[model samples]
Target chain A: MNQADSSTIVVKRTIAATVDELFDAWLDPDSLAQWMHPGTTALSTASVDARVGGAFEVLMHYPDKPLRHHGVYRQIERNRKLSFTWISDATQHSETLVTVEFNVASAGTEIVLTHERLPGQVACAEHTQGWTLAFELLADLAAKPLVLVTFDWVPEMPRGFVRDIRVRWALEEAGLPYRVQSVPFSDRNADHFSHQPFGQVPWLTDGDLSIFETGAILLHLGERSEALLPAGPRGRAETLEWLFAALNSVEMASLPWSLLQFSGNNDGTPGWNMMDSFLKKSRLAHLEPLLAKREWLAGPFSIADIVMADVLRLVDRFDGLADYPACRAYVARATARPAFLKAHADQMAHFAAAD
Target chain B: MNQADSSTIVVKRTIAATVDELFDAWLDPDSLAQWMHPGTTALSTASVDARVGGAFEVLMHYPDKPLRHHGVYRQIERNRKLSFTWISDATQHSETLVTVEFNVASAGTEIVLTHERLPGQVACAEHTQGWTLAFELLADLAAKPLVLVTFDWVPEMPRGFVRDIRVRWALEEAGLPYRVQSVPFSDRNADHFSHQPFGQVPWLTDGDLSIFETGAILLHLGERSEALLPAGPRGRAETLEWLFAALNSVEMASLPWSLLQFSGNNDGTPGWNMMDSFLKKSRLAHLEPLLAKREWLAGPFSIADIVMADVLRLVDRFDGLADYPACRAYVARATARPAFLKAHADQMAHFAAAD
Candidate 1:
């Protein structure tokens, strides 16, 4: 369509997020599902084609009806701009042009969204409200880069087994950018306790909010990005529940058993042997039946898998998960992810740098 | 304030919740905190006076400042009506009468909230908007009565140890009413698997939403009521983290160790003995120092405490918690709550009813 024949409407919003992060939200299918829809409508299905001339489709689900929007990417400029042709069943128009420009602002990223080739004024007005609400949601999420805090170094045995790996894996999986800060493991200061009351590592700082507990940090991040979770309430709830199950149920057993193995107490006493058997019969065995039924704990790869895999990997180190083939395979499948590999390498390098 | 002299504004809503459940939401401190505030604002504190002439106070906290509202309960009728006086610094009037009437509706509960004795037109309009939003929040929550599904009976050992206790405790803590249904323990049919994929008891159904996993159920309930959780983001996050810690961490070890003890396999196998020792040395011992520093796990009484206490209590029965004096005291303190008492009694009676 010629510029003279088409009409254009622009909506601008300043978000409290980095240019790259905010820009990535547009191209990432998971992130788009989280904030693209209006009101309480959830994205039932979202698929992305990030390159020029590639096509993308997203199905927005409401209680009564589902609205599917599909478009072809006409222009792609990472962290700067994105332009595409949009068509939806709800709209009378066969095709419309939508362009999003991301500019670095004092606070964060300023997003300028322009919708061109509108059929009429009514469609423009309706889309204006929809885009306004969508940006508001994005702005709220892009408000900050979550800060992950951890230790500079730890004991040799637990070197790769640090709690910070969970946080790193979580951030990497979500495709969220974060900076890591370190504290002394042996000599924890009052400030450390202020952030993490237990004087533990892997607390998080998101803007003015300081949150302790690795599970809590993961949950906070999960709330913002759909990569670690899902937009549907039931899916989100399942992810959360499974995440807890991994940490509280499986890890609870594995941690102690691994500690015994690390401390040279493996099969040393009756107690040590009993603990090993319990880990095998109670935690891992129970998990086998559950894992056998599905590849992922919550049906989709989520934070639950990340935490569960991390914990179970420790058990596998001691060969405790041998009988539970499904559990072992589940852990292997999760660690095979590029995100997990990067997180593992980065964690090892972090401690190596301090050395 | 007499009805003749006062100006009353009635905000009516048809919620999708049972009359008893909806009515109890007002008297329940936890339930009130979830839906009482406007928009994203959270309750800092909510204390209930569920009797006639008793006083109550609720502090709604914003990021910048806090708004405190306190008044006397003029009347209370269970599953019928609740009337109280509303006062805040923002208001010119010292007191305003607020009455909420709950009636059974075709969809759910029809709630008519009457706010009387407005100072001016502006105040009237603002309060109207605030109450309207608050009711919308309630309607969203009350639209579903969470269902707790469990087995009719189990082994003598796992009788009181059923997972349903966690749900019952959470519901009681939040002052939310729920109905209990049973399945045959010997044969968990396909219908049971539909609700609980794991074929376990204690799945929850709210409206059309059915969720399994005890941790997930508790978290779901926490979203609706502040009693099982806290109103503030930090508190709620902490509660969630700790709840996971209790279930995944503490319960993971405790369940196995307790099962070994109950089966009289305490020293029967080397694995059982080792698990018992690990439970003592790692899980329970690590919890002691933390409990020594605080009365509750997450600062305030929450589902975290209930789940943790329940898990630790099992440890106590096996004499594993003897060394952890503080953990014992913490469990004692949690079980002492009236809600916990009622929940425990109800759970016991539920099994008894089948017998």
Candidate 2:
């Protein structure tokens, strides 16, 4: 980038992507097709030769007409940097030097794009605008790099009920990319509360959208893929209603009820009797009939089932669901889901590591 | 219903609407514009004279072109029946007799729509389907006839924490039509459990769709209108995440802590100490920053605010918000909304009546 030359322009973006991932997006045709085009243009079709001296053509489909840009790779240093010659009609059909550097940054990877030796000031400005628009879309590549926030460790009693398992289950179900970050269970600080107001485990960060609460995070992930949430109006409605049901309805009883069981406080105290009666009469009894009739709560397998099954799973752990065969069966069926199994195992491993 | 005659057809539906509301839907032009369509047509431009022997014309916008269906009121019986002369292109441009009876039934207002003097079998079949389609939309009248089921009464300690206030607050915020139904607090039978799995009160019935759990019910109501929820993606995403944060994150700590207060159990016991530590450290301290920064949890007022405020209200009842001014102000800000005031008053009244 020549700061003194008015004919050259540079743009930089710090993307939440790994070094290799950001570097590869520029060379892969499929990846290029997703983010290479200017904001005004439709999808760009590209074919890349990848190595040095290899030629590439990207045809961007605008509403009015198609524009083709051809370039030759001058240098390729794997994840480090790439320098190429870019020739387009906007550049007066002249060859220009384009370099992209993927630098390892504290947050993620920062990409510095330089386009030099433009036709004049206008071409430089156009290329700058074009690259800026492309970067806006390129930022989407970072959106998938989710951070699942939860406690570092908890006791055996709250193992499955640690709640992060719900989010892990959802991320797995959606086939999303996420990494778990644990906070200190014994010592929570002001920083932790900023992300999760309740200082609870299982908050999630998707790009800048940091959301706490298991149900909220599940919903956030559910919106990412139909595997977690359906797209249609009817199915979406059912999924939303049922997902809330698992947390607000089923878990409202199950959580406190499970805690009592954990403490062995069910020695027929008033608190114990109140919780037990409510669990047996209010929750499990109603769940039995509904579970008996349906394979899943909503029309298909969805995030709603993930929450509902997890809520009932806690009760079944304490042998609370013994009489409710359908509820028991439903729990077994949902836990048997490959994603649930993976999420559960992952959560157990996360805690074991902390221990 | 005209069971004996094949030429005459009758369609009946038990709509969860008041007799007066059902009868009014037939006479009102705005109401006609809502549901009076052939299932394929767009919004209907309706102009109704309403009185006996008065005319009405509904111009339905179909994909291809516009269609005009005209009618004259032959009889007007307020809440009882509506007899009119129906004519359209499908009726061979010939006049037909249509009578609608709104009878009070055990479940709701049952509407019997009978059409006679059709041109032929094809015309009869077409009108049968058209009216049936109209009824399908008319059945939506029942959708607003929400039945909020909760406990009849509880002690003063559990008065404001009854949970139904969440749904009631949502309903009022949305300005939706609903009625409250009470189940026995002491005795929750098999019948009560049918609607709610945890035999909990506060399960909601929206026509045929019954959803239990305060969060689920609020979401269900939020979907009905943007008043309790935003329609835009960003706003909705914030609403959903914050709502779950309120319940699963904030209330997860507050509920148990409040229970300990209700029992006056502050003896430094392990359970009591654990609940206390979590409420102050994990929840309120974290919530203070967010409440201080934002006027509402989402971009605008939403169901998320309702749940969050209500959760804090319980804590405030026990002087829990004394240390956190932001959390206290947030609760005050939310409860000051007219809907919350009405819901709280009505809940108190309902329990008081039972007492």
Best by TM-score: 2
DockQ of 1: 0.20
> What are the candidates' individual DockQ scores?
0.20, 0.23
Clashes of each: 15, 7
Q: For model 2, how does the per-residue alpha-carbon lDDT over B149-226 read when each residue is reduced to its tens digit?
A: 788678886776688998888888888867566688999898886666566678887766777778877887887899
Return the lDDT, model 1, position B66.
69
The whole-model C-alpha lDDT of candidate 1 against the native structure comes to 0.76
After TM-score superposition, the amount by which residue B10's alpha carbon in candidate 2 deviates from its true location, in angstroms, is 30
lDDT of 2 at B114: 89
Give the true-structure RMSD of model 2: 18.6
Chain B alone, candidate 2, TM-score of 0.61
